[model samples]
Each structure stands twice: as C-alpha cells, then as structure tokens.
Target: MPSSLMLSFLFFLLSLSACSLKTQTTEPEKISHINKENYMIPGINHGLIQSPINILSNEKHETKNHQITLHFQDEIKAVENLGHTVQLDFSKGSSISSDGINYEFKQMHFHTPSEHLIDGMTFPMEMHIVNYAPPATKNGIPHYLVIAVLFKMGNENEFISEFLTLIPKQSNNTVKLEKGRVKLHDLFHDDLSNEMKNYYHYRGSLTTPPYTETVNWFVLKHIIEASPEQIRAINDIEGDNARHIQTIYGRHID
Candidate 1:
C-alpha cells in the first residue's frame, strides 16, 4: 500500500478507538444523572426535616408543652392495592386534637423492610396511620400527624389479618368492606388508649414524593408482632418500598 493510504487507515483506526473509549467513559455518567433525576427532584425531595430518619433510642429529648386527645371511630371503609403499597382508607368523623389543632384520620399504608430505624435496627414491616388537617389558607402547607408502628416477625397481627385477604389483587384496585368487617380496634385489642400512651414524637416530612416537611410524627414505641408468612404476603405485593433514612439534622425526638 502507498504511504499516504497507510497513514489514512491508521488515522481512521485511531479515531474509532477514541470514540469507543469516550462512549465507555461517558455512558455511565449520563445514566447516573438520569437515575438521580428520576429518584429525586431538586427541591421537592430534599429538606432539613425529611422523614425515615434513624431514631436514636438513647438520645435525650426536650419536653414540650402539648396535649393530645384521640376521638377515634376505628371505622375502616375500604382497602386499596396501590402498586407500591397496601393501603386501608378510614371513614370520616375520626379526628385527633393535638395542641388545639384537629387532624382527621385519612388512611393507613405499609412499607416492607421498614423505613425509620430505631437505634439502627430495621424491622420486617412498618405501618403508617396518616392523619391530615387542611391548610387554613389557600397556599399554606398542610399539616400531617403520622402514627408509625413497626412490626417484628412473631405471632400473627390481628390488624393486618383483618384486611390482608381482602386486599384487591390488581394494582390501583379498591375493595369496599362491609361495616365492621375490618376494625382498627382489633389491632389494639380494643385498648387503643393504653397502647398509644407511649411514643417517640418528632417533626419530619413524608417518606414519599412531594415530601412536605410539616409532618408531626408519632412513632409508637411498642413494636407490634406479625407472622413471617403475613409479612411476606404484604412484601410480595409492595416489593421493597422503604425509603432510605435521611439525616436527623439535630431534630428533637420527644
């Protein structure tokens, strides 16, 4: 071959090698950016008081001047099978008054492998009893009082058993229950006041998207019990939906 032709061939090979190397190096960075974008919104998912934080059991908490009263009806209307979680909707008229602010019972949902950690310990399941108070103003931030109950694998939990089989098989489906078919009182053995006496209280954001930072979290100190089979059944439907723990940011846990 002529020298000029040989030189041209060598240049072409070099150019191809460089292009391959560039793709190999840059592809991962591009993919990583997309993954981050999908997982987190710039300002929405981040905040100083984000949820699912590790609750240090030994940490000292300041006593706050607050009073809480529960006017619960324990009337669950329906169960919904969202793709990401199993949720039970509550009937209206049940409300909790905390510091003169009233928050009504809305719904309860579950997360597998838990979200919040107690002394860095992860439970098999976690349930959130979400209550909400509408904002006073048009654009004000809404208020939330979330009661979190962590569950360990032990004897079967009556609360979970009530609606476990009743959950709709398909995602986004809801099954309306007969009156008194499923009761939250059964979970506490009809002793909700005694069961709810002790808790770890804090302020945090919702674990899911639009993680509004106005949540008043009351994590029940008493860990509940559920059978391994029951936990597996719920986990199978929801998969691993627990969010990663966020920084505590020196927040108070009372």
Candidate 2:
C-alpha cells in the first residue's frame, strides 16, 4: 500500500475509536443525571401530591365534617412477610364510607421509622390500612383511602402481638390464620369507629411505586403504642423502606 494511504487509514481508525469512547462516556452521564434528578426532587417526575409528607399539626386550615362510617368485619385471613414489610390481609365484606363514597378494606402494611411526620416528628413505626374504590367512569382514576397509624415505643400493641409471631419466616411467604385469630378490631381496641373520628385528613399518594396521587390519607391524631422489641423485629425484616418526605404542594390538611 502507498505510505500516504496507510497514514490516512490509521487516522480513520483513531477517529472511530475516539467516537466510540465519547459515546460510552456520555450515555452513562445522561442516565446518572436522570437518576440524580429523580432522587433530589421526586415531584418533578411524579405528581404534585405525593405520600409521606411532613404533617404540620399546628397549622390552621378550614375543616369540613365528613360523615364517616365504618362497617368492619375485622377478620384477618392471612399474614404475609413480604420482605419489604409485614402485611395482614383482611377477609372480604368490610368497607368504610366517608361522605357517601365507599372504600373497601384491602390489606394493611407497615413502614419502619414512620412515613408521615407529625409536628415534624417521626415515630418508630407506621401502619397503612389500605382501602380502594373503583373509578366512577372508564376514564376516571381509581381512588384509595389509606388510614395511617403511627406507633411509638411503649407498651406492647395487642393487635401487632396477635400476628407478629405468625408472620412467615421467609420473605414472600404467607401463612393462613384461623378466622378471628388476627382481628383488626384488636388494633383499635374494638372501637374502630371512635378511633377514626379524631384524625388529620389530607390528599396524598401511595408511598410505594406508581405513587398514584388519588389517596385520601387519614393520619390518626392519636399515636398508638408498641414495644421497642416488636418495632425492631419488624424493622429488621423490612429494613429502612420509608420514602423521603415530599412537598405538600398547597394541599389541604383538615
């Protein structure tokens, strides 16, 4: 081959190598930027009303009396160790109605180190009683009404003690329970109606994935009590799975 042709061929190979390196370097950087943006400000990617916001207890806001009614069977059929959290599954035929909108009780799950902060305070544990209502129209979004209960380290909680030992040892494992063995009524001291009366209601999303912003959050004003050992046992299984607090975004807290 001619000397000039050989030099030109070498230059072409070097240019191709440089372009490949440039492409490899910039691609990861772009992905890193996106991940960082999502981590720093989740609302930019998700919706405005996100779950686990810091609730300000002292803030004054307009309130409306929502005629809430509870028709609870309190029958827990199974207990699941989901790796992410301990869950208690309720049997069918239990529902709650607020202002004529009915939401059926599905299941309840826990979050360690509490998700929603009260007066800028995080409790030892939090339980979310998840309820759902189908969309009114085909194009309408599904609705969720999550009742949150924060637990502080104190006396052992009766409701938790019922199923704490019954939780399956392996992750994703479920153990069937005898009917009335693991009742949700025990959690509310057999008075769910009264316990639900004094709560701070707001609009938020699920703390977990999809983070859909159609949740009607009812964080109980009264913080419940649980033993430190019980809380630690649950945290050990779930680890630290609490989503960081999101901005309130001018949402009402009644």
Candidate 3:
C-alpha cells in the first residue's frame, strides 16, 4: 500500500551520500549510558548504508523475485541479558539462504518500540534473527545478514512466550533453555514459507556498536503479535531498547 509520499521518501533515502548520516559523538560509552539521542557507537559511522532505515510499502518496490529460505533445526542453547537487550543463542544452529550464499543464524534478539520503520510507522516490538555468511573467507570476517520481524499488540505468540519466561530480568544475567526443547521457526507465522516473500530488502548496518554496513537486511511485511502481558514482561526487563532510525543515505531499497 504505497502512496506518492512513500515512493518519494524511498528515493530520497537512496539519494543522499553516506557522509551526511554520521553523527559522531564521544559522550557516554556504555549501553547503560546510552539514549536514543546519544548512541556511542565506537567506529566511523559516516558514508555507509546504516540501519534501521525505514522500509516503504510501495508497489514499485514490491517483488516476487526474492527466494528466501529459513532453516533452524537446531535446539535452543542459551539466553543472555546483555544489559541492553535479551538475546537467544542457538546450539550448532540454523542456516537461511538464497541463490548460493548461506547465512548461518548466530543469535536472535529483541528491541522495544521497534528499530526499522515501515512507511514511517513504528511498531510495538521487533525481533532480529542475526545470521552470518562467509563469502571468500578473508581475514575471517563473515558477511552479516539479519532478518527483522516486527510485532504488534494482539494475541500472545506461543513461540515467543515459550522462551520469554526463561529470560533473566537483570542486566548481564544469563539462562539456559532446556536442551532440544525449542525450534526457531516456531517463533514465526504458521504460513511463513509463503508469507516471507512479501518483504523489504536493503543493504544496511548493525544497529549497535561498531555499526558496520555489512548486512543484507530482509524485513518481512507480515507482522506477528504479542499479548499485553508478554509486552509488559519484555519491557520490564529491557525498556525502550530500540535505536533511533538512521538516514538511508540514498541507497535504493530493493
């Protein structure tokens, strides 16, 4: 459902150079000292395709060409409270791919108030499934790919609540999910195989420290839901964990 304004905004994002997006600062350094107004990302942030950029719902940008596959047959390993947010890591975990490149799922995390915006619309929560692909293993730095699934307030997600209860409330705390008890795909829509095609594609960076522009972002158009109690539990642990949206820098959204 794209309008003229949405299309205009899409082009405008890709029209600017990377240098303008840099907001370098030397203020508070830790996540505890961080706020949306001040993200002490320790790196050169200028002149790159940074995230979380707004994803427009325009007809021209729609596609049936992307063939995305999600593979997560691994069991849940452990969950950690990394001060800023809660993260779920898998054991010898999953892989998602398209064409020939394989993206290995590293871990999954959450952000309240969402990160990447859709047509300037911010949702209640966002889940990022972090995956890495090694392309020509040079210096051992693998290519990063993140699949972002946004959430609205509605019926409770069984998959999410399945593990949400195991998350530690204190920062730097960690917990272990019962071995061989969980699956990654369960957190997604029941019809994910067919629904994942309707997504927004773009080249962007990590929303946290060392904000590198080494990511192939796949943001699904379909949103999942979290009940009121589930939302309260997440917020109670890590309130307002989202990073402010970044400038698109004129990079075309596929």
Model 3 TM-score (2 dp): 0.76
Count of clashes, each model: 0, 0, 5
Better of 1 and 3 by TM-score: 1
Cα TM-score of candidate 1: 0.81
Write one digit per residue (lDDT tens) for candidate 3, span 33-80: 232323634555433457898777772354536567877576678888
Model 1 spans with C-alpha error above 4 angstroms: 1-45, 63-65
Model 2 C-alpha lDDT per residue in residues 1-254, reported as the tens digit of each score? 99999999999999999999976655322433333334545445555667888999876365667788889888888999999999999899999988678999999999999999988899989999999999999998788999999999999989889989988889999999998898777777748889888888887788998787778899988788999999999999989889999876556678
Which residue pairs come into collision in candidate 3?
Answer: 13-250, 14-250, 14-251, 15-250, 18-47
Q: What 10-residue stretch in candidate 3 is worst by lDDT? A: 25-34
Model 1: which ten-residue window has the lowest total lDDT? 27-36
Cα lDDT, model 2, residue 117: 93
Q: What is the C-alpha lDDT of each candidate?
A: 0.85, 0.85, 0.74
Q: What are the RMSDs of all candidates, in order?
A: 13.9, 14.0, 11.8
